[model samples]
Target chain A: MIAILNAYRYRMLIPVNRTTRVLAGLTAALLLALVWAAASGALGISLWEVLRGQEDPFSVQVWWQLRLPRLLLGVAVGAMLAGSGAAMQGLFRNPLADPTLLGLASGAGLFVALWIVFFQDSGAGSLYGQFAAGFLGALCVCLIVFGIAKRQGGGSAAVMTLLLAGLAINTLAGAGGGVLAFIASDEQLRQLSLWGMGTLTNALWRTTALALVLIAAALWLLMRSARELDLLQLGEATAHAAGLDASRLKHRVVVATSLGVGLCVALTGVIGFLGLLVPHCLRLWLGPSHRLLLPASMLGGALLLVVADTLARTIAAPAEIPVGLLTSLLGGPYFLYLLMRRNRAC
Target chain B: MLTLHQAGLTNTPAIAPLDGTIRPGELLAIVGPNGAGKSTLLSMLSGFRSAEQGELHLDGKPLRAWPITELANRRALVAQQELPGFDWQTNELLSLGSNPSKSLVAALLDDLDITHLAKRSVLSLSGGERQRVMIARGACQLLSRCSPTAKEGGILLLDEPTSALDIGQQQRLMRQLRSWATQHHMAIVCVLHDLNLASTYADRVWLLHQGQRIDHGLPNQVLNPATIAKIYAAELQRIEGGTHGKPLLALAP
Candidate 1:
């Protein structure tokens, strides 16, 4: 059966060749975006000159100190958010599931707001402090959602319960962030609002390196569960009979998403919609197989963020728009289109 | 082989304790009225739900004691109304976990009369077509993983295998199941709603009512018109002289 299917897939050019083509295309696009992003900043450093060892020292410094770290951070954060989104959708077995929609990003954002409001001046505004706050917030929300779903028992009902719980948590976190914002001093408020809108403005080698390690580890774990996730699409009971340890898969997804997405929110604020948009687009083009979707989403997401961040900073040169705002602006309409298409398909 | 030693559930809509052994090369039909714990019994038998009151043994060991992968290899369950979450091809769906060879898959699909659906998306198939596809997948799961020297083909448990099939398709499925049981030396159990199908196809019949097993024996003896009518609380007429003297049941106008 597998041989016949493999032959059919080859004839249709759907699985193997398509996966290779999509990944290769996305990787090439990402490299282009990286070069464009690295060279298109305010100082206008010429990457070609730098490569040829003929660029001015100041331009090299600007590229090394500022653009390089920010670009790397953009790639890492984008991949983390998109990869988590794909994994969450697979875990929940819902095409529309995403980290932002499920409140992981907001939960992290809330704690970051709290940190800004209450501890910024007390030596707790360090990078590690921000990550700890964000991760704790995400973990709390993850536990609450999983706990409620477990109580509901398993099946489609549990998935619905988890989604509704996510909605409630998103609302609650938004309100909490509001309360913190209202009480924050003017200087603290500026920091809080800027961070809430999401940015890579704080990109530094130390923080970027930390985010890289954590996000890489999390993505690896998510990728490893691709086969189990495929079986889960048959529903939990059937998957269990097929030898899947579903509860263990659930735990892995929750921990990986919380850690990966929490760190993204901490380092780059709440970059909404990239997670939802990237994976959804890829799924449409490549079919819903996670073996390809996860890696493809990672590359597609990195390409998008690099381009968006470039446009964000260079569009208004010397006066930046938060990349998060740009992504939401782009993502909002695309998500609406997806909903309409789904309704039509039904 | 599965042995149920006073095994049952204690939850609402519970099943009363059942003591029985399902042996290879036999087709057992579990016939029951609404809310009669047919599905609940099947769940316990599949080890998806533990027997709250007693024990279920597979090959003389506790059902729960077998490693999950080994248990999966030995028994396959096709639950009712399964809708695939994605648009997987029928063949891909069959090969999800078991890794069946091409010949085995083709043979299973042919037996279930779904060979034409091999490359079609499961989501695009009709209800009856999808039902057959899932059954093929279940059989593939067992056949692909069965050890070469094992005495019996693994057990195949099906929940309402013919609920969506047409009468002709239903007859074909029942015959195919019987063939699998006998030819492969498999133990097959089906939860059936149609008494006539049970009587016509099953080697043995278990009649359940309101969480209790009222009677179980050869189909001809257990499907007596008077006992079925009273237990079902309905007007049922029995037609004698069925194939091999099996009793056929029909609803009275």
Candidate 2:
């Protein structure tokens, strides 16, 4: 229902005046919903009680240790992946582009495989080992993608190169991960498999706080480059005439999007389509102006992911499903719907 | 005030190779072949493309030197097929013309002679109406100057203004332009395909071929039959020559 309303709001065949009003309304709704969902996770918790002047140890522990951290991480992850995808779409002018250009997913996956291989049986250094492996692996993949993208067009090649590079590395990492899992002892294999599927289960206050800082900084940078993103849709030459410096904007978008993607990739093994689903839907509803499109995408993407995260915990009576699996299952259909609709339009 | 002297802006694949200058309060017409660099030249002068060589000045300062807002405040350009229609709420599309007085979108729509169609979808307007809407939007940018004299600062860059309009609509627009250009003293730099229309209204014409300025002067000098034949690679018969004796070409054979 909201998507249809957005479609009407963004109808270029109609006047922009009416569309603007409609988009404004839609933006307000999405924003309110976003705030409501984030707040709901800690509705009666200790952090909420503290801020509201009610001291309760049990609620505080639950809020700070669980709900508060999850809320922060969930919103950051959703917004970062969604905004990164939208920026990439505008930068390369291809709607299919996603956050994986950094190769963080693959890099992280490889590191996780190594961690399991070397330290799976050991009890100590587990958390630090996972973080180090994931962070290093993702960073290495980003540098490699950047290296290959440089050969193709430096800052401005068709997005196909990025997608292709991501696909190859993603496949290699997936293969390597599979092989490692195949040979692991039964107990280690189960643990590796469960973790690999992705979860926000070990949510920590410090980790969530750090994610917020990185995500917010990245979002701010993306907003600054948005005007140039508007110009990009018309092709590089047209954008340049619109007084945008194309190469400069491209560099900024790629780097900032990488940061957003890298952070999320490190935190969650590999979640797809938050970026794809959000922007594409918003474009259909709000038209293509980046000012409205970017924020709207963020709001919708964050809300969708948060809801998925909630379902992940509640569905199996505390036997959790990896939020990544649910996101893929739900998002895969939404993506197919977008593809079918756009193809018909073409 | 805008000035371009021996300006040559190069983009990949030979899209820009034209030379010319546009000044305050004067309407200059750019007429040429499809790949003749009209878009490129316009982009360069409007601060979108950097001229690989040549001097372009806005208010006597180099175009590149002007601040983004200062440049936007002074110059407004509508590139060809940048917006197509005929549907956007006539008023909604018009609002994009000027940012400050955007609240008066309805008034602008009425002034453009489509008030009745204000409620209609933008896709429903005729091609001529769509062209008028583009001009109206460009005018919005000019309105932002707000100088008492109107001519103190204003430049409009339009590409293919009449190609979308019917003959009657063309005259209505051109007639309005005479007053609008004079009242605003707008430095109107437009790329047009119609020679007769160019001769009828434009104060000056810049003729380009293969990214080169083959001719630049009064409409009569630029729109001659021999020149038209050579540039277009077509035969144009001279009959009913235009104002100042400029030959009108109706493709012969």
Candidate 3:
């Protein structure tokens, strides 16, 4: 009976090998991060109190309303950003592809800044507007990058063009944001800067709910194409020869990535390094198969962001550093380390 | 059966109007000098590139009419040397070629004499070993395309299957391919640069030059001294007898 089951398992495209172990480890880490984030805020609430169903007003307000929403939003935003990052990396067949690197964050940032500076007075402050405009901006940048890359043909040439276009778009968006910053009032400037730094301070229940839905949908799309993504890493011609519809896969991954990153930025501002850091480091640990990598990155990203946000809130108690700033601080050094290690290996 | 009825790609640099029919249980070896449309012909035959002016049919159905998934199952192409983007076990890599059963994949690995390397990352394999693995992968694709009971024969398309192999390895691979062609009753078209190997192994040879078919016949008839001299622009001393009763041709000093 056991042998028969093993035979069945072995035939599965994404087999059960090492997946359970990885999932278990990530789940443990996630639970730990969740408990830590929920309990260690400015208004301290123990996990025990929350577990025992505390009904005190302060505990309810702090734990359920504030801390819980923030933690869950961080989880959704991180998962979306990192899951999209993994898909982008697979689509481009490059290790350096991240939402921030591809101008999704910058484009969304520019739109959000535009709204904050120009449209805030005209009732554009709603959560729906923020998600709609920001996601649209991200989707536009992603599709434009994809369009330019497609024109360049396949393989490393397309990936190179996509990266260059990303850099150009990011620079243009940054300049636009700079101009917006220059003309804004002090209050507007502060708000814009805080948003730029990346924070989950705006993790209200309504926005979190929308982010969860969008993130879940995007992740589903990415997961559905996991096998195709794996084939794509063999190079576009190779993938096509292997019977994958390469163009269709690219379209799906691009659309999913944009929706994911767009909503992520809208919810938590432009959180930078989680996308790049999570997938790159995980690829080294787990190898490069997207079936495992995509789902694993989602869980891992959620865990990392929750921990990072916990640190952001607690390290300087009563004074919160934007979670984005904390992530950049952690992610920047790691990126450099990876670069040096890769250089040495090469 | 695969037939190319005036199937041609005139705009393509290396291939002109190609016409041929490759039937099951036959082995056709394509030989040409560099930039002589060998790979291009194989590409069209494998349905990677569509014929510009004419039609290509497999089992009397136009190549384009076949769904990609079904076509992929029936035809597998092993292109020039490819380096995977990540480290994959040899077996895992082969599985990506087609959805073959695990037992079948293991058998293929054993048949290709790469069973020992199955657990190793493909990145770590030598070029010759990688080539063998690639051929095995293609074979697995053909195997997966057929049911155990029905056994629908398929075609194996290979671009320079032995380019990196040592002489002994090359002979072993050729013998293995021959056995596969006969046993599975699958059509095999291989692009080869070495004339001697083609002469020794190919049941029929197709010689091409300047985007045109120079000759197509049994190896001895097509790879004659006069045709070699004219197409290759080199003089060669043609020896009388070789292994398998084929003539041996060596470059004249």
Candidate 4:
């Protein structure tokens, strides 16, 4: 008991394991790849050579200042979104469930549209303002989803009610964003469109710091309740008989995972589907034990995002395609494949 | 070693519920038609549902005070429906029954003649095979880590152990379970639909009528044609001199 407490106090936030070994290895390779791409400006050289002076006076100022921060931002956002997706899938017992379920992405997207209209210079260039609006938007959507679902029963805790609530909120937010987009100018339109697609081009230190702290705390809270998650999959009555406070466990997980997701959405306007895709693949590899699955999911999601993000940047040289586009383009067909497979099996 | 003191489970709270006690090593069979609260009574006693009016005790201590692991270790309940999405191999499913403190589950599977199914996926098994696996799981729960002799006690709560098995398989499995109970001195509370099976297998029977337990006694006394009719709302034909002839129940048109 003493040793456990000591380990909790002193251990590295991310524990090293076979899963983590692969994660760290991939992270190193991706980080190196990202740094190399930025330094060399491997595609269109003139467009990005403005901020590379951190390492040496002669080095291009754009490489160190602009590209490195964006890379880190992608890494952080990917991990958080993936973690959120993992939690959502586990909670719903549906492989297709994602961070977008509670309307966080649409909510964040709406706020970015409204922010771009109201605030001057509120794109990737001025990230804190955008992140704040995004967080508040997600937070507000969560409250609404919670209120609507809890009144009916409880969102995401009871699978059907949660799924319905997600669908309802997602539709409402999408409609609201469409109306907002119709009213804006060409510049606002362009900014809103890119934000809707999501990017990690503007990760400032303070706001990214917020995401790191909030997400780590959230993941920690969720990880502590992994055993309860295992018992819960057995069903509520069984979980209760097994001496778990089922309602409490469900609420805790929702908060931890949702908050982690909210922070990620705030950082990178609205990344889609990593959470759903990563956990589903991980569950097939690791069994349903949350203690094993959650950590493995985090690494798997991060690796998937790294590979996807690398492709996103490299696929189109001069103009970087939004990472969310890659996820949507890739994820939808894969999701369809899984759905058909499950239907056939059933 | 189970006692439910004036326990009440009411669809409407005004109705008075039944009270009962099941002693250690006693095979108590609960018999009633559909919706007699037979399953409800079993569920309450097994800690599936909370009792409103009275307390549930295991060996004189309150049932609520026991931790989940300890409670699970002591009472092994086979629920009514088949639990789906079980991806375990047959032996692994049986091993789940083993308490962490006990020996491996191989002994029970060996005794039950399920050793050949050790590597087979439990989900792919037939109904009779599945029922046997469920029983094997409950049996393994009794002896997982330590070599628990038949003397070391535990409780076996079966809602309908032989409900799906053929006559021969049902008789074989119940006989094995009865022998295990006799050797171990553990309480066995089984909810049974078969009157003849109860008469032949159970030491005592608890008969319920419309959510009320009307009688609970030795099988011969409880299996009377009139009492059976009162609970089942049908006339029963009593046969004499059959295989282990007790009482054969026939539905009257």
Candidate 5:
């Protein structure tokens, strides 16, 4: 593992600087979070027991069947959320842009509600249908918000209009999901509620693997556009005048963000505030250069979500709270603090 | 030489079709009344906008045929307005051009008298400071394309570079740009609202009125009161043979 990491040390897209040191620190934090999460769950399997190869059937099942998949899913979902947030922030050149704030999560949730109420079936095809519908719904909301923002002239007012549009869509999607819940049968309603309050308890190895692959693909696409994103901070006309095709860059970022956020919501329901805070905090420390920001945010998000998920399951002792609830419970105040700080600075 | 043969936009004929050539080792000031297409002309020369009517040739090659990166290496533009979202340091912002070169960046900072502001956040700069930094960035961008031992001959397009600058900084910037052009055989095209500054430094002057070319010649021939009144529609008195041996115009109050 160290050898693999060492290979990556020299192959980073950006030059090695203080930001690289910050990324290394984030990686260490993520590793620590993984170990803490593996040990501190409801089943109470010690890290030492797993490391020492003690193979009691119950502990072995808890270790292999339960903790591992949940942690793996956390890593995938967290990385996707944070990476997408970083990309969205870069695309809009606004620090406040994120999947949850932009209605992507609720959009996906509304479609998932539709799948649960109308298309619920005990079959593999039905499950895939939910994922596809969720993906399409997320993409649709993203495009709608983008279209509205662009129509408002895409000037200094673009960010304001985007946030307002996102708020309206989130309210609409919430109302739609609520209506679906009102009509759902008892069993379908229970499933929909459980999905709404996100948890990694339902993670399977196959789905975890797929989510990881999708997150990695999205991160790769976002990272490829890092240099252009940096230039775009100078504004569109300047970026274009400096030889970048600004419109093409914006298009590519939008498509990549939709795919990334879509897969994340489909995988983990609505993991609110993870996307917003991970990149915003990292940008506060590392500055707005996307080259370092994207990678560091992925690691930071994985660390934050894993730690939050661990607390979620362990704090309530076996009767676990939703990981999404834990994230918002923690991240909401932090986001408010950021907004207040921005106001103070202004 | 960069030659434009009746090059102009057709969609918004705000700029009439015009012909001109920008030669190496010359500083050409484009002076005109408001809305007379000075900015449009600068946009065309910098290849930011394509002219529908005629051809623009660079080194005997068509302008549109040049790849973006290739064109970027050969030229740089300092726009009239800058609105960056981040608090990037001046040096960092300057490095975002096609080429990022440490030596070139350092030399530009020193030459443009912005060396002290190198580490300062661009967000914290005053308007004049930002304008100087932008010009320095453009110069560094042009210098980045030069071989270490070769003298670079790059085109610089400055659209109202002096608007935000104080009188002292403006004079200093123009003097340095003039010397730099002569020393490096660089071709420069600047749009100036101040007619005296145009006459004082420009090797030649191109005057436009209502998007049409009214005059193109040496500063003396272009800045006389008759032509100034004809285009600007203001009564102006001229003081000839200033310290720079060029005409200076003032309102006849």
Candidate 6:
């Protein structure tokens, strides 16, 4: 028995060691990206000099007021989106499931657009108002998709029903946003279009703080469900037989993903594909165990966004491309490639 | 032990009320024609579906009343043709949802004849191989939680467990199941299509026709050729006297 246990312990160490190594690597890369993003903007401000107070006062101000909050917001939004994506995929038991694909982001964007059109001048455009609108939109869409899935009787059929529901919600939300855009004034149009394009330029200290706290809470909830998510991959009935409260798990994941993805869309304006791309790639690297996948996806996402946002700002200096455009540009082709490969395999 | 008192489902693939007691150290086979509600009956037995007419009791308490986790500790179900949603190593799949000892996991893999497939991804396994892996997982779920001093190992419910297996694999699996029932004092209920395998391995057999259990008794008494042929609506020849006088059934060519 002792010998058998020792062998098992040694066998278990392989995955644990790989998890530690991968997480450590991701953390180091995230720190490097943070420093790099902080340093390379419109104004070249070295992080070391900013810390030492040797940079000019104006450079320090730019670093603190403009760059720091944006970078922090980028980290929070990216982590939340990717973590929520990983959790969502696990909950639905489909690798293709994503917050954006499931219409959560578009729903949130529509509500934020509504807030911008009607409530902007009414002093309801505060962070709280935007978050509430976005959260409600996401929650509503999530419940609808979940309801449709439940009605379909939940098997492979439910997965297809979920995706179809997402498609319908996405179309409806897009049309609503277009209507909102059509009626807006020129100034409001510019704000709406820029927000729709998804930039971190509007990142403020207060919004950044709010995004961090809420994203952290959502991510914590998702991570707490890691084991249950793993069990769910066995299919719902089998998972329930294994002692999981399947309905409760579904509710928790639905709420967490809504909160996380909604807050991200509200703050960052529908940053496309970070949720889909980060978790999908990390699953290939670390396998599908959520105990490791969730945190790895979170760190990987933060790193990707920090690096991508830095490029978005610096690549065309003096004017910035929306980071959303950059991620979509990269993620869209990869998504097609994944679909092609899956088709070929089939 | 699992006791069913007029338990049945009213769903589309309905089952008439069934009253039966499945005891530890016994392997009970539920054999029926396709669309005969065999799997539905298994689901009711596993407590995945509530009995519309009556109740199921696991140990002494109502099966539905037992907390899910505690019930999981007492029972495990292996469904038909389940494909895992993600790629998991064979051993990882075996130990999922339960913390079985290394020796127990190894033993299950060996018993299932898939020890060599332990490190391979479950997605890479053939259909028969994956079926065995799922059965081991079900066994692990029960045996790991079973207390040493407990009177019986928990119930294991299987739905068409041998549907994907070849002849050799089917024989090995059935033998292993019988061994587990005898050694671990586990009550096992299997929905099988092959009546001969049931007759050979199962201590008792329940023959179903059109959602109702028409007959259940010792294999020899219940699986007699005349009733099986009538219920199955197929020509069958019963070869008399083999291996302790158990009936050997074959289709009429």
lDDT of each: 0.87, 0.69, 0.83, 0.68, 0.82, 0.89
On a 0 to 100 scale, what is the lDDT of residue B125 in model 4?
A: 79
Candidate 4 docks at the CAPRI level of incorrect
- Candidate 5 pairs with clashing backbones: none
Off by more than 4 A, model 5:
A1-16, A118-122, A153-155, A344-346, B12-14, B147-152, B209-214
lDDT by residue (tens digit), candidate 4, A247-279: 677678767765666567656667777877877
Winner of 1 and 6 under lDDT: 6
**Chain A TM-score of model 5 versus the true structure?**
0.91
Model 5: per-residue Cα lDDT at residue A266: 69
Docking class of 3: acceptable
Chain B TM, per prediction: 0.98, 0.87, 0.96, 0.89, 0.95, 0.97
Better model by TM-score: candidate 1 vs candidate 5: 1
What TM-score would chain B of candidate 6 score versus the native chain B?
A: 0.97
Better of 1 and 4 by TM-score: 1
Clashing pairs in 6: none
Query: How well is each residue in B46-99 modelled by candidate 2, as lDDT tens digits?
Result: 777667777777777988887664566677777675543112455545544235
Residue lDDT tens for model 6, A267-341: 889888898999999999788899999999999999999999999999999889999999999998998898799
lDDT of 5 by residue, B42-129 (tens): 8788877877888999878898998876787777788776767667789888888656667778888888889999999888899989
The ten-residue window of minimal lDDT in model 6 chain A covers: A119-128
Ranking by DockQ: 6, 1, 5, 3, 4, 2
| Best-first order by lDDT | 6, 1, 3, 5, 2, 4
Model 6 per-residue lDDT at A286: 81
DockQ of structure 3: 0.46
- How high is the lDDT of residue B115 in model 6? 93
Two-chain DockQ for each candidate model: 0.62, 0.12, 0.46, 0.20, 0.51, 0.71
TM-score for all models, in order of appearance: 0.92, 0.76, 0.91, 0.79, 0.91, 0.94
- Give lDDT for model 4: 0.68
Model 6's i-RMS, to one decimal, reads 0.9
- Global fold similarity of model 2 (TM-score): 0.76
How far residue A4's Cα lies from its native spot in candidate 6, in Å, is: 32
Tell me, by DockQ, which candidate is best: 6
List, residue by residue over B195-219, the lDDT tens digit for candidate 3: 9988998889999998898789899
